[model samples]
Target: MIRKLYVIITTSAALGNALSLTNQTKFKRSPVGGIVTVRAGYAQTPFPEWLTEFTGLTEWPGIDPPYIPMDFIDFSKVPDYKSYPQGVCGVNPRESCSFDCDKCVEPDDVYTCSKLSQTFDDGPSPATEKLLESLDHPTTFFNLGINIVNFPDTYKKILDAGHLVGTHTWSHPFMPSLTNEQIVAQLEWSIWAMNATGNHYPKWFRPPYGAIDNRVRAISRMFGLQAVLWDHDTMDWQLIAEDSNLRTEEQVYHDVQLWKRGKRGLILEHDGSEKTVNVGINVSKLIGDDQLTVAQCVGGIDYIHQYAQK
Candidate 1:
């Protein structure tokens, strides 16, 4: 899961202490309204690949503060699956699509709504670039991973294109298994890399494999990052099913079922692998037919907050 990006504003520790310390990004009144000042840490560099692979044990920041919304935008206001569980597409017979599970059905097939929602993860890859180009409709939210260096130039293109860039660690490691120091290095290095290349701090983080424990949550707060997880999972990660040569139709069937069961707000996916990318691209097409937009289609996480508020 790649976290979203934001500007980091640093202030001295003395200044930081004067206010009722709330978070790394301190929220204060500035006469006009409330202001949040984000802190910048020293650049931590390239971590070993093994540290980030699991993503279950990723660590948080050393700073102690409650995590607050870095972006002022709210998403609760936007129309989404929460408001329309049947989704834009409503129910259809099992034979209509390949799967027989109720969860796999698109909301539009069963409901009355006009707005669409989409959110993608593990991107800035070669496939992502191709997908971006091939998109007949633009993506609503692109939660991109920063740890994978194989596609640095590809990431640069993504940033240059104005998509939301987030931290996925330097190597997509699990957050739970890593020590505090290891976690910090993974996150900080990714941040440094993103800053060096794109000049921003990530605002949101999704634990790799969507795994987050109390310690992980604590670290997220210290860094002023909201731990973001998804309501929908397509399970596009499984490239092959039971058969070696063929994709797993049964598992894909299960994904649709799960999606139907948990309809709304944040759809987890990937762009690092070819199969996932293929499914994601296909999913986007389905979304368009149902009058939904991917998260990037609507304005990314900032918009998600807004949509959620209403």
Candidate 2:
């Protein structure tokens, strides 16, 4: 499968800790929250194609004791994930574990909940415009920074419609394969783009392909993002029906209907394409107004933006 920005959170795995300073930028000190002190890691000139206007700096102090990386990361970049070595996934305990791989570790990354919930991923897409139009209540959309840039007007419309927005990374790359620094670049850049575009700082972070682990989780936590996974997956990305999760239109509708109220839980849907968008509309209707946004379903946090999430 192409896995074009698939859903859910997975175990985080890393190739190595060695950061290549070949093209790294200069930095200086900047303190945050009085408790944590960090410096900015500026993006290299002629930055990565996915670079946003917040190209000033991407900073996260190395994972050291008593020094937590600040959540207010205004930096940006999409490090080439393929350039890094593919670490030994769930295969090696010493190495990282990828959600895409078997034997992977699992802990955080909200996959289930008591109340029913709905969340869309890899969007602000062309088709998502329709999805937004169909929403009756506050919904949560995990948007891609690239899509936000491509569909600036739609991105703004999402905010205007009162739907919650979260970061799905700058350019969707498999998280487990990226280094800690590279992971920081992908996440910070995406966060900066959303903040710059909508004046919104999303607290929810859904790793591409459900890929996350201890290292990935730690990095995301520093930036004040909660990684989300899913218990129910409609697999709306699968065009043809091979199985229930990978079913087509009618099957997907059947799949949605299968989830009885109070029984069904947090599901992974997409607005990445027109087909998915059409299904999303029906999914919402089928799930009904009782369905809560991820923020509400996973309630505890007061507001959507950065605050204290318990």
Candidate 3:
């Protein structure tokens, strides 16, 4: 009887310790006010291809999965505004239109900037400070609203270091799947959160997962924000957090090299992973001395609005 009781107690203690360890390692809630949970280790995706499919839902060339569920906004419901009278139609008038208009002109979807722009996404994490310290030059940080709220100090540090801060959205949802109102809400909430942190509202916004379209760009302009896309994707986000065989450090370098080829523009890296941070520390070697901010690369448009003015 004593042996049986001892076994029960021992089992209970083991289970309790196991649960404690799981809780400790699974998720670490941010100290500030937000739902950003930093996990201890990489959460590997089961089928890596699923991530590609999930992000590319809008542009899936093949037939989508049966009963693919999505909730898109009826853009027709949004009222339209005529182009400003002073707007320049285009150089030839028959091919394209100039974007320098008062009205919500189509966002200039910049692929390659004339100069190299170092940009990181999904950040303002604890790893961010390390990244900033390692870099000899400033880089643009496209921060999530949740992370900015949870780690305002980190966001401020990025700005204090003279790095540009851009919105990466509140919850990091695929923008194309959201309603026009939902999309604007994401940007507005992020801008407000950053402003609340005593930083200027970010004028540039990067759509999560690189999923965006004309409608998304139009709505972004409604909030006086511009959509910034990447010319080179380092795939650093997948280096350690994915189940694919391409999750090695070598793969990251290879991907960056392949994307660079002989072009200079906005290069995408993430500051959310330690592995990525390491990559960022050495990124300058690949891109050379042309590191620039988004605004600088995009012709020095004002990409930050002071909160006090708003």
Candidate 4:
């Protein structure tokens, strides 16, 4: 292994300005989107004695070598879609909503106090990594719709990152459109592929296109997975990359406005597409700026299961 050396320069020290001088070196940029590399030089003499004598930053005992990766999305480079995801007409996600318990009934089936758990679908791609990194790794869980048979590394990365990997129907087919056995196969194959990563059993299932019926639900339940459906969908996937004219940001903002008006369960989002990531980022910032608290549903799945029992 090549040993690495690090030098720190405090912001207020005599030699503080000198540290910026060393950043002159430039490196290659990633051929793929939103990633860059940098070059660095280290001397065996320990960062020139003159620099260390004046700047405590150079002498800090606890200073360690940089290990953080330099991969990130430049959202600016990501142009607005020529087309945008189809906006929902008539219905707003916010407002009163009803919860269905397969068995018992609650006195008040609909309420506005509930919180929504947001989960990204159809990902494990570079876009997924970028979005997750942007969020600062909040406790928000992901229902990764991984087609692991193709991208094994992505499947491994999703599990390694501690996100929930779920079935997206192996080939991204609609669940309701398939026969019962096919649905079971889709669920089973996803689990099998996911398990190969490290014996992780998925506890969630997101039907493609949010198409789930009783049979789909039953198949999911049989696999010990809860059927996940999005309560708020901005239709980010509908955007066309080549269009020069399209959905307005106001329309996206309106979707969020709708979300704020309703009771929550799952906020449907897509992780595989840039348009989706962009919208998610916008909503996150809006929620933060407005001082709205996004609920951390630590026991989201449990709550759903328990609610079902009641």
Candidate 5:
């Protein structure tokens, strides 16, 4: 890594700098209307610290990756794969890993507010302004890089609103299905996006689809990102559809009502769409102002390591 840094003085760090981007708009729409982030001033030689592939040309780079392997990844941080004959964990992770990473929810970590905590994922979407306006209490936003680039102004508003921000990967992909380098690319690109736009190196990460394992956890930890899992799932993304899988706003509230008290819930929600945003607003109202952001619930002063600090 040191050698790679020496070899490329103008590393991807330049790519990360807001000053280097000549384009006023972070991205542009292609003829087909697909969002393509302008790669101007991007490093010709990728820093060992950043992505070797998946440079955010498209919205979902990791969704259908060629699974290219790279030499730059720190293999020492990765753990050996193991089978969970209990079931296919990739299909149902709650039963397999069931790893709850929120600190205040656990007893060992220093205690803070025991209030019910909610986390919004797959956002800083188009509805971010409404969602930010709707919440009296701060919450954690596990945002995707695609959304962050697509909605840069709204994405910046998250920190301005006093909400904790974390990476939800560049493109929301099933982690276990990806190669180790692919996993690294996904994580590093997300980190790059956060740092470039927000000047934040997020300490928290939520694996999209809960598709994490020992290997995934190890890789993320090496990059200083802790993987967080939720206890209660609102399944609010279903609101975008009119199918049998759809969970109505009323049903979501009813489920929340059934949740037991005193045990702080790391509830899953979204700000990714109009429907989910409305449901999140209503849920915030129903749950009242007692709720806390994920970091506050975990006794954390802040969840990001600022670039200025580094």
Candidate 6:
């Protein structure tokens, strides 16, 4: 059985403010286009659990709550594989490999340039606006589909601020374990969710945990997304989520040191943690002028796909 609760926000300004606030309150549009706010405190459920429920996968064993893989993904809904052309091995068509191809030297497989691309993954969070406000330059946000649906207002704010948005998959799954059809579903659902919120589809995709293979890249190409990997990883997610021994302030210095060494490429960080937010604010002192979005770093290759009419 499902229980439904709604809190109506009568004004657009109020709705915007409510959405922009923290992720404490969940908002969704009603069938008649009314604003419905659902207080997230009711069940004390973590965001991942809520995501599992939102994606309709509550009953799967061991795969409950935080586990991303589930039986809910319907392969039949994905596009027919024959509809797209086959991928080449190590050339124009990157072939699927069993191992992590992020270190591949192929030009097409790599996403580096002369300038440093500031990129954040797993966001559209309550902390996103604060991070954006702290930076004088634009950054790239690789968002999850579940986060987009849960926080549409935050997602809209990210786009409105002129930051480049990309797909980080729907549930932040490890791509290697998923079938090709499942990979397609992850990318498709993310793109669809982003389209539903902001009427824009992303042109770049960063695999969660930097976990990608030839198959993942091929599926990404099928959806018209270029795979972007990071050169410098701050390990902010480990520090925050896993309580690693690395201190946040130390990581900030480490990031600055990398910048000081003239290591210019895609720098990876997460917007989901407060530690990362601090790093983003302080790193500006070092690479503020050098910071560029993934698109800008790559010579402004049209990364925006106009899928929605807006």
The TM-scores, one per candidate, come to 0.51, 0.67, 0.65, 0.53, 0.69, 0.67
Question: Which stretches of candidate 1 lie above 4 Å from their native place?
Answer: 1-116, 136-149, 240-263, 289-310
Higher-lDDT candidate among 1 and 5? Answer: 5
lDDT of 3 by residue, 163-207 (tens): 888888876765555555666667766665676674476788887
Each candidate's lDDT (Cα)?
0.42, 0.59, 0.58, 0.42, 0.60, 0.58
- Model 6 lDDT tens row, 268-310: 6778656667776776666766677887776756356665453
What TM-score would you give candidate 1 relative to the actual structure? 0.51
Best-to-worst order by TM-score is 5, 6, 2, 3, 4, 1
Model 1: worst 10 consecutive residues (lDDT sum) = 27-36
lDDT of 4 by residue, 1-310 (tens): 3222121211111222221222211100101111111112211112324334433334212111211111231223322212111222222221111111111112211111146435666664545656665663442333332334434555555555645555665545544445455555566545544554434565656666554434445446656666544445554543322332334456656666666665444455566656667777776665442221122242333222211111
Instruction: Look at candidate 2 and tell me the lDDT of residue 3.
Output: 23
Per model, state how many residue pairs clash: 68, 9, 0, 6, 0, 4
Distance (Å) between predicted and true CA of 190, model 3? 0.4
Model 5 over residues 67-118: C-alpha lDDT tens digits?
A: 3334555787676664332113344323223232111122221112366667
* Residue 301 local lDDT, model 2: 55
The total of clashing pairs for model 3 equals 0
Off by over 4 Å in 3: 1-35, 38-107, 258-263, 302-304, 308-310
| Pairs of residues at least 3 apart in sequence or in different chains that clash in candidate 3 | none
Best candidate according to lDDT: 5
Better of 1 and 2 by TM-score: 2
- Runs of candidate 6 with Cα error greater than 4 angstroms are 1-102, 302-304, 307-310
lDDT (Cα, 0-100) at 114 in candidate 1: 26
- Tell me the lDDT of candidate 5: 0.60
Worst 10 residues of 3 by lDDT: 1-10
